[model samples]
Target: MASREAPSPASRGVSANKPLPPTFKSIQDVLNGEGVAKGTLVSVIGVVRDLRRPIPTRNSGGSNHGRGPARRADQSSLTANIDWKCVMTLCDKSIDDENTAQNGATGIELHLFCPQNAMPEVGFRDVVLIKSAKVQDYRFGTSLLSNYRTAIYVYSASAIPMPPKSAKDALKPRPGSKASHVEDDEHEYVSWMYHSMNKDSLPEADVFEEQANRSLNVRDKFSLLKDVGDGGFYDLIVEVIKDPYDLLDKATVWVTDYTENKHFYHHSWDISNAESGRDGDPYGYTTAFENPTTKGWPGPYGKQCLQLTCYEPHASPLRSQVRAGGYIRLRNLQIKYGRNGGNLEGYLREDRAYPSRLGFDVIQKSEFTEDADSRLKDLLKRKLEYKKKLKQQKEAFAGLENTKAVGAKRKDNGESATKPNAKQRRKIQRAQRDQEVQKEKTQKAESLGLNKQVRCESEDQPVSSFDRILNGVSWRRTRENGEEEHLALPFTNIKFRANVRVVDFRPRRLEDFAAGRKMSEYDCLEDYDGGSASGSDGQSETLDSFAGPKTWEWRFALELEDASPKAKGEKPERIWALVDNIEAQQLVNLDAVDLQANQEQLSQLREQLFKLWGNLEECKRHEYDAHLESIRRTKLHMPPPDSSDNEIEENGPEQAGRRPPDKVSNKPFTCCLQQYGLEISEADPTKCDSGEGKRYQRVFKIFGTAVR
Candidate 1:
């Protein structure tokens, strides 16, 4: 009838009456419900696949008892809340034998709620041993949750923790910490079991090593990239189409597979529906790497064009070495799908060794090389043919312009006796000026050695810079038609400047400009195929034949107003302008990479434009009084010293009595139309003929804007 005493620790299998530590569990075992008892602690080891930025919790109203407004207090408390929590994804090959550690099925997400101070201890690809962590079912699946007693031990590459000399050594309590007793005991148990099970092998010890060792070849064709899972290292031989551009600390390069000579041409002649021609190429075929559903769609393969991202130490030097149109071989590059799920992007992987941290070899093609791959020769031949076709297209366009100019002159002579109105007369004079300007430019180009017959091989040739071809050519005009013929002024020669308020920006979506239905980022390169090019208004226009460069330019509706208005009643006039890459870069102080990658940069651009022109109400109140005052002060400067002055003039007699310098206008904004040798006649500012039946209307193309 007496109560039985509990068994002593020694009787249960201990020599000195000590408690045993919790059993170590593999991630697979934990996920399979091996240790699902409530409040049970389990140990697991894995490589950190992803670590999200720590997100600080919002401060509750309880702390604002003596503060001012809740919103104001919230704003002030933004940095005070240092308690941050983040979710991390960890993976180990043991979880799933069929899955690769990278983008593999063996990964599990863990939620770690901790103070912001603890964040820097862990990073991507770090091997970690998590101890005493509680297992819980999460929205994503089974996940580990770090409780108050959970301990995370991160292993540094240089000093990975080796198994203790003995189980007793690992279990011994440390001197400085009270928590070490439990942690040390648990660590010893896990290490003992791990070594006992695998005979000296540690879990996830080779996780980081596996990625660097496995190198995929360019011939793999991105076939190895199947899921939205783990990323891997790859080697590629690609041509640099877009050079490395910076975005914050990282640099990006756009490349294409040069060895794959698959001729997937999207031609204008193959378009099935002329009505929907402006929408997209109907008969175009998609590449094998893209979505299977879009097999016949008009778009480039995601594989054909891969974006390389270089970070930290690799970015600066890699950006300098890569150049557009150059063939380069990249090795040990990291490949991962972007967040947008469109294409597989590559990045330069930092190597542990010195001297060769990143691999990038610029391949200089040589006709004399005896062992060159046949594919390389074919690539060169294709490039030459493409360039030749581009040259022919340019010459044909120029010749067409010449014929239109002659026809315009004959028409003007026949209609001279009709007694044209002021607007009509202005149009006729503008036409005459444009004709002369075109003829002069044609002759000038020839004189400058822009050979009409062959491809312009020299970079110094005016034709080599495709700005004019991509955008539009410039022309001169007379402000007043009947004014002295000698008074005709040339348009502004520098990048076009304009004093205009941004009335509206088109295409609110970034994809509309870069990955639209009808066009890719470089669709303008294919404009030489003939037929009417798509215009900003979604209409076809033969006159404005060249569809502007894709992604390089943004269409904006601008309100062209005098920076310094002459009258209080003056109103702004609306015009359209195509802002090309260079000007957009200057205006927003951002490159295309940043603009496309970050949506916030687009908002920043709009804010910048608003700051320049001011909002609608602010712009309306802007007056020219200050500008007038500046002009007055400029004109009142004292005349040059007379001969009586002691200082000797260079040509004393002739220069002694020279007048003051000419007074310059204090205009609020520079006129881009004037800078580019172009203008809209005052008689009819709505539209003007840009030669060859092409009437450039309300659209005012601005290349740059003055800083406010």
Candidate 2:
């Protein structure tokens, strides 16, 4: 609905006040409080230097100026629904001189509040005479307000008449203006002021037009929070998701347009149950595991909200008016990279070009009517979508948790070995059962337990294949009615105990088991260097320059093959699991150091590992050395770099890749395995540009199996 222009007071038949003699004060005198005090009624005449369009005021209920009951829906008369506020600045010859010297507007500001459609029709360079305006001292500065007795008179700069000889010839005040009649002295004063001011010479005239045009341009450039980029200004319509927090000079408020930005800080809700390291413990088993605090994050979840800092003048008003769940429009909001350069944040500072007008406003409910701006409509749609997405996320998380509960219940009842979805699980159960039957038949009753070795604490647990352990839990997807449904989960809380034989050990040799630790300023506890292990010599200049002690720690992996008896045609399964310093120390019963120079500890490691997997290390070493020799022979012959393996195999016996000298003569050992995930990309989940399109990857690590 269009806003209605106020009707004339004469048209409304308002009785005129008795004429009073004119008493005008200089703008300088009024501002300095030389004679007039705050709240004192005074009169002044000046040129209209700047003005703003009428804006709807907060609906504070009061008398409706005898306009009958307010019909806010009356499209023809917006004044019937709400009060209007118009702001303008006035400066006369005395103040204009000062403004000219300073090259800015130093005029007295006037705040007028009246019934909607009753705003005074004044324009730039016009002469205005205001009477009975009450001086007000606001927190920001001093200003003038309209009272019941206040009256306004305007004389067009090009149309003011010469001195009138009679009362009938004198100009009369316009409709809706409270002035009874224009005094002859006031008429002469207006005429002289109008002639004295040069319309082309006024600087504030351009300021008023710039402010209006700037507003339209900014609104046209409205952008969603998700599309915001660094070092650009944009206007935004956002929902305040969290209440504004006050700072001494600035305030911060978190808001969202319901679109996710990857650079925004990730907020995890209690239901999402984000993973913490060290086997998914809620608080983590050790201080070395970095856990993100999940408490007190009032979330739309994920990366949907942004924190905006409002400075000084903007902060004061925003803190008082904006609340959680309220809607607002921010103009010329700036986006920039925050400290450390990873996340993006917003900033709102005072606009020095127009200090009187703020860059933000509380969006009134009435403005959201059917004909509202398109930007506002988009904001409303996103808000609804956000609510729906939040609901779906919670439901998906619940479904995953429920699935885990059901699996645990079945395990407790000894039903885990029953027909399972994974074929590998079924094969493992059958193989272990067959071995158990054969052992019972061949061993004497008294010596049944003598030869068997229990390497892991959870040896009594069911033995699972590498395939079953890797696929223990996954993101299950299904389609019904053409809509694909998938669980939205951060990580699954699941672990496994597996019977496996060590077919290969990483570093390919026992001498490289211990590695130099990477030093960092924030490092206090030992970190698990699984994916990132320092391979350089401990005497590197980077480590030697450190003020703290240089150290070496064990970091390596074991490639294990499932040891369960398999069907004649079935293939064995293999997987790699990391063994960090703590787990390695338990397995070898020695502290880590530069193992190549420490023959005593190196020999001890070989002996200790012998009990877990007999002669497995020796077999792996022999195979590795032969493979290296073949690679050297191929390079010495200078074979084409891109030669196929088939061509190289046919070259000669020296180029043939040698197989393991002997089968791994190791007994199967039961060890605990943990399946977890690490985030590979913090980018948007919708984009699957490469293999990293998924945000995280599943990782398996060995834990809790000590060598005897």
- Which candidate leads the pack in lDDT? 2
Write down the RMSD of all candidates, one decimal each.
Answer: 21.9, 26.8
Q: Model 1 residue 506 lDDT?
A: 45
Q: What is the lDDT of candidate 1?
A: 0.44
Instruction: Give, for candidate 2, the lowest lDDT window spanning 10 residues.
Output: 65-74
| C-alpha RMSD of candidate 1 | 21.9
Listed in order, each prediction's TM-score against the native is 0.31, 0.36
Candidate 1 lDDT by residue in tens digits, 150-231: 6676543233333442233322222112153335655454343333221112224354334323321112222222221237
Q: What's the number of clashes in each of the models?
A: 10, 2
lDDT of 2 by residue, 1-708 (tens): 333454432444332222223577877677777788987889888777777655544343543221112222222323333366666778876564534333244678787767655667776567778888888654335677776677877666556643221222323346575645567666666655544433443545566676644433322446788899899887787888766766667877788888899988666665444332322122221345333452244557778888788897788888888888787878778899766477778899887866765667766555555444455667666655565566656656757356677778867977555556554666689778856864543332222232144356665555555654555443443456666565545445567776677778888778898887544311221332322222221335663554454467788998878765665889989888889888787777788878888898888888887876787887767666557767887879854334355335444457556433467777776688887777576567564322445566667788887777
Angstrom error at residue 662, model 2: 99
Residue 303 lDDT (model 1): 28
lDDT of 2 at 532: 20
Report lDDT (CA) for all predictions: 0.44, 0.64
